[model samples]
Target chain A: MMDGSMALPFWLDALIALLLLGGALVALLGSIGLARMPDFYMRLHGPTKASTLGVGATLLGSMIWFGVGHEGLSVQEILITVFLFATAPVSAHMMARAALHRRVACRERTHGEPWDEMDRLPGYAESSSSSDSQR
Target chain B: MTATVLPIALALFSLSLLLNLYRLLRGPDIIDRILGLDTLNVNAIAVIVLGGIYMDSSLIFEAALLIALMGFVGTVAMTKYLVRGDVIE
Candidate 1:
């Protein structure tokens, strides 16, 4: 395992190191944001944006590292990247919808009127009355 | 030289995972916890890939792929349940 390092040139090693470190740090920052953000809506932004990019970078690094040494391109790594890029936003949207339907409280600093006619939307019938009671 | 950098990457990823766990445990709302869980799975995939690199094996990549698939489905199901108050409907 260790002997593979000799096969890779120093600059390639540096590129991999940079990609791995950068991705990990961004991911750590996203998790930090998730932990630190005060409200659910604010917290949603963190992992959705930073973590997606983090994993994408890390996967790219893996692809490059494996591709250079292997017989051809690392197609599996590409599949993960594509899958993540497609799903991350969709999950974030669903989570946000769930939060809204549940009437999760938002921070005062949040500027938008998220509640305006929100209950009229599908799957939110029960929440409209509850929203009125909570106000 | 390449071997020396693997540990640092692993440590950073571990720290991120710990932060995600804290969010999962300390959530003031269910959505927050769900968000934590979603992030956790993504980070886990990254960690698995890094492990593959460290171990010099293509086999671990299969595990990473499976995780990515299952994690997305799980997140979507959980979020749908939260939104509609039911999974299938």
Candidate 2:
């Protein structure tokens, strides 16, 4: 039996609605950034950061909705939030390195412009132009 | 119980999925595309969770768990390959 007051149902619904709204807002911001960012590395910041949070909030909202609806406190919803925190960065790192291996170049448009410049590391060819643009 | 909320959440999640699709298509670089795929995976998890909510079934939670566990492994291995050219040292 749900221990909380009967009024809790209304509260829970309100909470879920707020969470969904927040998640949608975050998702929207990520999409905007995806379109607005100028370079690959800059673009990486959008979905990895914002979309992850967006999905997390949305899933968490769903989890709470169902858990409370069923009058159970199971935390199964946390699985995605935990997974996102773990996987998103690793994937981003991999993609960034792969792009580098392909000699993917960056645009010097963002605040942290150091990555755009070719490093003097051994065994890597320095390209004067962004790789994707060249293609 | 609020009957309409489930359908609304489903619709919103699908919209998010579409946004991720746009990234996959319009990415200027390969890594941007990979990032988009990662976003897609997370969005997929959200959809599964929301589906569980709508159906009042816990089975979807198990699938969500598997995705959570394996997705991390897949991403780590892929990232390792991208960085060192091999998943294992």
- Top candidate when judged by TM-score against the true structure: 1
**Tens digit of per-residue lDDT, candidate 2, span A10-62:** 87777887787678678767766765777776777887788788877887776
What's the true lDDT of residue A68 in model 1? Answer: 80
* Tens-digit lDDT string for candidate 1 (B1-89): 55777788789889999999999999999888889999999999999989988878767777888988998999999988876566884
What TM-score does structure 2 among the candidates reach? 0.75
Reference contacts reproduced by model 2:
0.45
**For all candidates listed, what's the TM-score of chain B alone?**
0.94, 0.86
What value does the lDDT take at residue A54 in candidate 1? 88
> Model 1 misses residue A53 by how many Å?
0.7
lDDT of 1 by residue, A47-134 (tens): 9999998888888888878888753456678888899999999999889888887779988887875665675678667665665466
Location of the lowest summed lDDT over 10 successive residues in candidate 2 chain B: B1-10
| Candidate 2: clashing pairs of residues | none
